[model samples]
Target: MKAENPKASAEVVWANNNTDDASLRLWREQSRQLLLSEAKARGLQSTSPCLCGSGDRLRDCCLRPLR
Candidate 1:
């Protein structure tokens, strides 16, 4: 499913097409926030693995977006 933000798709494509860590990080942070929000809405615990499937705890992942 596509994200609600139209620009997100373009940004993802651009980030994938280019080897830019800044852009990629920005996209990743946005994705993390979205995933976290969705998971919270669905009553998922923060101690659970991130909804993004990174295998890290949701609280840890979202709290430290730079990682």
Candidate 2:
């Protein structure tokens, strides 16, 4: 199973009224945009990934080479 959202632990509260595909899709797209914006704001290169448990900082010692 996929891991739950650490930031959004309350599932029912967030997905209560919306019980349709369109609502779910909109939520997903908004979530994606939020994540991307947050990543960009943190100066994390979109190409490289942070894997050392230090979030996505580029110099966090777990920065992998960009593909």
Best by lDDT: 1
Q: Estimate each model's TM-score.
A: 0.46, 0.47
Clashes of 2: 0
Which lDDT value does model 1 have at 25? 76
On residues 1-67, what C-alpha lDDT tens digit does candidate 1 reach at each position?
A: 3446665453333335555878767867887677767887988988988765779987787556534
Provide the global lDDT of candidate 1 against the true structure.
Answer: 0.68
Q: Please give the lDDT score at residue 14 for candidate 1.
A: 38
Alpha-carbon shift of residue 26 in model 1 (angstroms)? 0.6
- Please provide, for model 2 over 1-67, each residue's C-alpha lDDT reduced to its tens digit, 9 standing for 90 to 100: 2227465444552346646767766766675566556667876664546433555654343222220
Clash pairs of candidate 1?
none
**Candidate 1, superposed: residue stretches over 4 Å from native:** 1-17, 49-66
CA-lDDT, candidates in order: 0.68, 0.51
